[model samples]
Structure formats: structure tokens, C-alpha cells
Target chain A: MKWALSLCLLLSVGLIFTPNTLHALPEESGKAELWLTKMSTAFSELNFRGLVVYGDGDHWESLEYRQTQHKGTHLSRTQYLSGIPRTQVRSGNELFCIHSGDHIAGLTPDVFKPLNRDLASKLTTILASYEVGVFSNIERIAANDAVFITLTPKSDDRYAYQLWLERTTGLPLKADLLDIKGDVLQRFQFAELELNVTTPISMFSSSESGHALRLKPTPDRVSSSEASWWPAWLPSGFALQGYNKVSGSEGRQGERLTFSDGLSSFTVFVDHVENDLGPDLTRRWHATSATVRHTRSNTGDFRISVVGELPSVTVSKIAESVTLVDQLASR
Target chain B: MTDRKNESLSALCDGECDELEVRRVLNQFSSDPDLREQWRRYHLLGSIMREEPVSSIDLSEGIMQALDGEPMDEVPARSQTPVETSVAHTAADNKRSRSQWLMSGAVAASVTLAVLVGARFAYDPSALDGSMSGAALVMNDSQSAMESEAISAITVAANEPVVEPLTVANADISAEELRKAQEVLSQYVLEHENEAINANEQGLPTFVRVANFGADNKTAVRKD
Candidate 1:
């Protein structure tokens, strides 16, 4: 009787502690999420410089990338090595670009914040749209051991992403953008990387002869509700990020609405047209698609365009769904 | 799987495998479970290398089973009708000619505004010198003098009416119309990228995109 009881106890303990059961748990995904979190933190916390090759199937460019954090401020510089001479410097939220003696300055989001906070807060939102996975195989990238991570789209509306992160530092060494068919549409990979190197702050400055052009962020006051026209349908998970009304010569005006789904984004532009009523046009540049549609409304002849790094079909659908607020009300 | 076979599979994933190699891979793929598993891993690895979502499930077994149930016969090749071939050639020719026209026309039209603006800045580089402080001041007031000047330049170019009549018969678009469309599209794309740089948590991809697209900060300065 005692032997039977002990056997029952042993069976129960074995079921609880089985290796397969432990392996089948969320440990793998949890480790992936943890690695992703580390990568996010590494971007702001680590100092690195490398030669990177970026391509969009149609075109490719080589660039020198350098990043460092100094006195609580994150700074990075990207200098094109293969193409037309251009340099972009980012100091905290301010971005300065120097090209052909022209200096362009603009503000970006607060990128200095350790990105892990944002990732942790929005993991649920992101997981809703993408399935995260970690590959068991260890790959060598940028001459360093790396682990592969993937964010697969739950739907066909968005593209998938694969990243190879350095195993030790968690810094991303390579990334690929995949279309729905699993073909690589774009790729950014590091050929050589040196971490923990000193990057001088002077590298982020523009020459005195460079012309300074400042670009302001979109005004926060112009909400989608106040827009004269808006997209009737957006792919799931997309939300309006900003809106702006632009005035051209001859009293002509246009509106721009931007939307993002955390990882992907697209913009809608509506402008008044006067002449040359051409048929609809679709243009592809790299992975980005630009679709233009001409629509005549009671107000005037308008040109609507949807542009983004999305599939051509998605942009066309978005372009077709734009409607004037008044037209919506009348309908 | 042999290393040679693995290389063939990788080439197939990249769409580089020739027909003979494709046939060989497909043959081995159907009969060997290990090869099938390797195929799945190769796809998953390919997805990861491409920075896309990975799918681990292998659906080829069911597909091959279904294919096995179908009757196999030597299918006759169907040649395109002469009329169909002529239509295809005509369409291709039209596309080639229209693109050729656009190449030169767009250059001339786009350069006009660029030269005008370039000359203005070239004549007085100092006008843009104090733009840093000017931008700081403009932050408080959205309608700044600098912004108006930039906006006026763009508006002047944008308001220029299309001179050529619409070629409705041939469906050929006018250069002015195409130029305007390009300008509008480029502006929105730039703005979208700017916002993306702000919104995206991933740091390097945005920089890669900006570099890939050639940071044309000249037009980025005009928006209010």
C-alpha cells in the first residue's frame, strides 16, 4: 500500500517537472521579448559605430553609422558613403541634415527615453498585430554571434520584420523587411561594428557655410475631427498621428493626414487640382507605394494620394476610400 | 540533406535556382520528411534574414497529397494569338515611350523650381544663417516670416497652370501635371518619414530609410 502511494506521488511529481512540459511553456517567447527589450535599451545606452548597407531591392547604399550617449543625451550620425554626399546628425530630439552645403534641422520624438519603457507599455498592442518568435539557431552577423528574432504579421495588411541581435550586447546587427510572400523587400545590415567606442560630439555639427533650413513638427491642434476630409477606412491597428492644412499659391489649399500602427505608417494627402485631368496613377519607389486618385466633388476637383511603405494594394484601397466630410454627411 | 541540396534550397528561396535544380529540390522535398523539415527551417531562416515574420508550419504535405490524386497528362502548350501579341507589344511600346518622355520632361520641369530656389539661396547664404534662432522664435508663433517666404516659393511653383492639353486619346500625361503630382507625393512622403522618425521606437531603420530616400531637406523646410 505504501509502495502504491509513493508511486502515485512520484508520477505526479514527474508530470509537474517534465522536461517537455517546461520546454513547451512560454520561456522561449519570454526570452525573445526579453531580448527585444534589451535591444531597445541598448540603442540608447550603448555607444557603437559601424558600416551599414541598406537596400530596398531596387536600390542600395552604404553608410557609416555612429551612435553615443553623452551626459544623458543620445547622439548619432549617419554619413552616406556610396551615394551623393550627405550627413545626418541627431542630438536628442533635434535632427540636422547636411547635403550640398544645405543644412536642414528638424525635431524627432523623444528618442532618449530608454525604449524598453515604450516596448513594455505597448507590447500588448504590438502582440495583437504581430506574433513574436525566436529562432534556435545562432547566426554570425557583423562578425559577432547573434540570435534571430522575428515579428510576423497576424494579417496581410502589414509587412513582417526579422532582426539579428548581438548575443552579448543585444544590439541589432541586421534587419530585414519581408513582404507577405516572404520575400525580402528591404534589408539593413551591418558589415562591421565596434561597440563601446568613443564618438566625439563634434561629429554632429554642420559647417558654417551650410545653409540652415528648419522643419517644424506638425501642429498638434489640427485633429482628424476638424479635417475637411478623412479616410473612411484604415487597416486595423492604424491610428491618426497628425493632421496639417497647407496653403499653396493662387489661394489653393491641401490637407495631409498621417497614421501609424506602431511599426508601420502611411500618409494621406488631399489637394485641389485645376487642369490636366489624367487617369489614376500608381508609382513604386523601393518598398514604398504612392497611389494617386482624381476625384471631382461638389467643392472642386481634388487629387487624393496614399503614400507609405505598404503593399501597393493597401495604398490603392486607402486612396479609394478617402471622402470629403461634407460628402459623408450628405450621404 | 546534402550541402549541395541545401544550397539549392537556399537558391530556390531567393528565386535564383534554375529549372533543373528546382525540379530536383521539389522531388526530394516531396518524398523526404527531413528535406521537408529543412525546407521549413530554410523558409523560417529566410524570413528572419529578410526581417519578416516567420511561419513554421509546413503545408506542402497536404498540397502534394492533393496533387497526387490529380491525373497527370502531357499538357499542350498554348501560343499567344497574333492579335494578342500585337496588343502586348503596343502596350509595352506605349509604356516605354511614355516613361522616356517623362524622364526628360520631369527633369526640365522639376529643375526649374529647384534652380529658382537654389539661386535664391546661393545668392544669399547668410539669409539662412540665423535660421536656428529664427526657428526657435517660430516655435512660439506658427506663422513666421521665414515660413511665409518658403511657402510663397512653393505656392508660386504649385500655382503655375498646366500649359499642355490633356492627351486623352493616347492617355499620355503632361509633364507639368506629372511634375506637380511628383511634388505633392514627395512632400507627403517626406512628411510621413519625418513623423515616422518621431514615432518609431526602432532607431536604425528610420535612419536607413532617410538615407535611402536621400534626405531632401530643401522641401522639408516649407511646412508650417
Candidate 2:
């Protein structure tokens, strides 16, 4: 009778503790998701300016980053302070590169836009591939108390990310992109920041030298039905985000397909080549990898290149997996 | 599947098959659903054994269906006769086979290299930050030399142009060819960065990349 009573008491403790332990994980992850949502909101709604230091491997540079929310329009200007003289101003979906006092305008849709209004829904999809976590300890960044968060990839196809977001404003004060090996591939940290700073309207205006070149907006989505070439395989979570046909000099025609898994992305370019380009070559620029392969189809020789901030092996696999539509039709 | 076919599949999974065996397995894989399932299972099992993350979702069925919907031309049968072929045809065949061999070798080498690099990084104390630190931090001093050696090995294996900043691959190409490739890659990188600016709410980080690239390009030009 005494042993039975002790067993019952033990069972009660296990039942009570098990529920709390299970609930703890979800609660922590929920808090991380909420912080991400708030960070996304603050990006567009909040106005701030600061000096940022960006580095990758041995390369490092300082830049002045300014953004303002003016009349529901997001305007941002970035100027390099430590390196070559260059300035860029972004207004809505348009980006102007000011070099030598001339503005080269290009339509970069959603360049500085807020995360999709349906971010709550999209976060579910992101969480499927990444394990989002909020560190319990607080950290100081740019003189502000910050909440550290990590978005680690579930697979080796993508790199990992760490962010230190300001506690009060939820603004990311420091960000780091870590490789699969956990090395810091790239980092962006604010050195000094000021919130709610008013900027002159002229700062966002185009240079007095006027626009030297204006580029047309890329066609948003060239449907799969219209695509002549497509990748036979992609990293699990990646989805086709954009597709467009491009014409290069000498009448070379090419198609560009962009794939993204919410946080990471890669682009495959298939171009008609006049001659064979020998063996496949792989290149790495900091975190980005570019792999090129030459393939022959019934129609002609084609050059396929996969470029992205991914591992070289992943990029090479993507390049090799590109299949010609006509070739597939005839297989 | 026959016992012989099963043996071939296993050999292929181990990457020990010759060209003819690979071709045979691939042909069978296209037609036999059972073989496809077995292949998937073998891969899943291998991944599990290697301690790699494996996703339960399989999209191969949908991919196969999509391919089946396409209008396929009947494959021509191999002729027994030693018929004369055009020089171009023979050269193309040789090139295709060589390319396939190179690709296969590269994939194998890269997979092994990735495992080595990953293992090294996994145990390196410096890889983890203060928040991630625990028992790993205790071994930092002892492992510093190993970490440096591993990093150098990775750099060499990746063929990173540590000497020439902002240059593309250090292949045996003319300076002009290298320049052209660099310009094209830069443009692609910039375009990709623009598209992914807001990906995962990473607008500022992506912008920083653009700015960095711009500065590097200018510096490269100045040096040249």
C-alpha cells in the first residue's frame, strides 16, 4: 500500500513536468517568430541612419546607411566611406547607382520593400526548412541592448544566419552569415546608429548630372509553360521565384531562372554559345559560388552557369542538372 | 528486380560502378518503379548512416510524372554493324563521355571534401560564438593549430583566389578572358543580390553586399 502510494506520486510529477517541458520549446520558438515579424515591420516603418561596417573573410569596408519613411514611401541611400567613391539611392522599386556624378537607374522591384505582408504565413514555410531560435541572454550592439537570434538551415544546401536585433525597436544591429562549416562568411554590423533622424528630401533625389542609363524592369515571372529550359533538380525547399529571357551582345540569347528558399537563392543562366567552353569551372567570390558547364543539345551548344551564395558543390550540381526543354521533349 | 540488378543498384549507391554499369542502372531506374523506390531507400539509408539530415518528402514521383507527360521520341537501337560515322559525330561522342567522367569525378571529390571540411568545422571551438559556447570552448587553445590547418586546406580545395582579390576562377585562361568572366559574374551576382534583397527580411545585409561589390569593382579597376 505504501509502495503504491509512492508510485502514484512519481507518476503525477512526471505528468506535470512532461507537459511543461514540451510546451517550453514551442513557446521559445514562438517568441523567436514574433521577434522576426517585428523586425520585418520595423524595417520599413522606422526611420534611421547609421554607419555600418561590412566584412567578409579578409575584406572589410565602412558605409553610411540612411533610410527614411516619407509619406508611405521607403527611401534609402548608401555611400561607401572607406573605399571607392560610390553612392546608391533606392526609392520604392527603383534603384539609382550614382557614379562619377551620373545616375544609372534600374528597376529593382522590392529591393528595400518590407517582407511580404503575409509574412506570418510565410514564416511557417521558412520554419519548415530552418530552425529559428532566440538566445536567452541579451547582448549589446551599437550601444543598444539586443536580442540575439539564429536561423539555422536544416540542410547543407543553405548557409546559417545570426542576427542581433535591437531590443526596443527590433532593428537588426548586427548580422552574420555563417557557412555550413560554421565560419563567418560575411558580417554586417552598425558602428553608430540614430533613430528617428529626419533627412533632407534632396538627399533621395537623382544627381544633377541626370540619368546616364535607364534599364527596363525585368518581366516579373515568365511562366514555366513559356520556359524553354528548366532545372531537373533543385535544393529541396527552393522554388522558382523569377524567370526571364535576356539578350546579350552579338545576338546571344539566354534565359535566367532564379530559385529561392525564402532566405537563400540561386540563379541559373542558360545561354546559346557559339563554341564549346571546355570543362566545367567553379569560382568563389567571398560567400558566392559560380559554376559553369558547357552542354550540347540537338539544337546547339549551350553554356549553363549557376551563381549563388551557396556551396560550390550545390552550385555545380544545379548547373549539371539543367535540362533543355527540347531535349526533354525528345527523351 | 533480379538479384543481378539489385547488385548493380548497390554498386551504384556505393559509387563503385563503371560507365556501363551506371548506364544500365540509369536505364532501369527510368522504367522500373520498384527500382526507383529501392534507390531512394538506399540513399535515405546512406544519408542516415552518414548522420546527414534527410527530408521525408520525396518529389521524384511528381518529377517522373511530369517527364512522362512529355512527348518522347523512341530511342534508337544500337546497331551491330561497324558502320562508318562522321568525324564530328565521333568527336561529339568522345566529348560527351569525357564531360560525364569529369562531372562524376568532381561530384565524388566534392562530396568527400565537404565531409572532411564539415567534420573539421563541427569540432572547432572557434566556430561557435559566445552564446553557442559550452564544453567546446574549453578546448580552444589546444585546437587552434588544427583549425588553421583545416582552414588552409579548405581554401586550397575551394580554389579561392586569395592572392588576386575580386578575380574569378584562377583557371588557365588569358587575362582578357578572365576579365570578361569576372565582369559577367559580377553582373550576375549584383542582379541576384537585388532580387534577394528582401529575402527572409534581409534587406540591409543584401544592400551591404551590393555596396561591397561596387567598391571592390572600382578598386579592381583602379589597380588595373
Interface root mean square deviation of every model, in Å?
16.9, 20.8
Candidate 1, CAPRI quality class derived from DockQ: incorrect
Candidate 2 error regions (>4 Å): A1-27, A101-122, A210-222, A276-278, A329-331, B1-187, B194-224
lDDT of 1 at A124: 61
What's the lDDT for residue B149 in model 1? 35
Model 2 whole-model lDDT (C-alpha atoms): 0.56
Q: Write the per-residue lDDT of candidate 1 for residues A116-188, one digit (tens) a residue.
A: 2245545666667778877655666655777767787888987887777888888877776667765555666
TM-score of chain B of each: 0.25, 0.27
- Which pairs clash in the backbone of model 2? none
Chain A TM-scores, all candidates? Answer: 0.82, 0.82
**Candidate 2, residue A16: how far the Cα is off, in Å:** 33
Considering only N, C-alpha and C atoms within 3 Å, which residue pairs clash in candidate 1? A152-B53, A160-B52, A161-B51, A161-B52, A162-B51, A162-B52, A176-B50, A176-B51, A249-B155
Tens-place lDDT per residue, model 1, B1-224, is 57587567544443333334445666787587777755654433223223333334443332232224322233222232111000001101234333532333333233223322322332233544443221122122322333333222211212111121221222565766555555555555555555534322332222211211112213443121
Model 2 alpha-carbon miss at residue B32, Å: 80
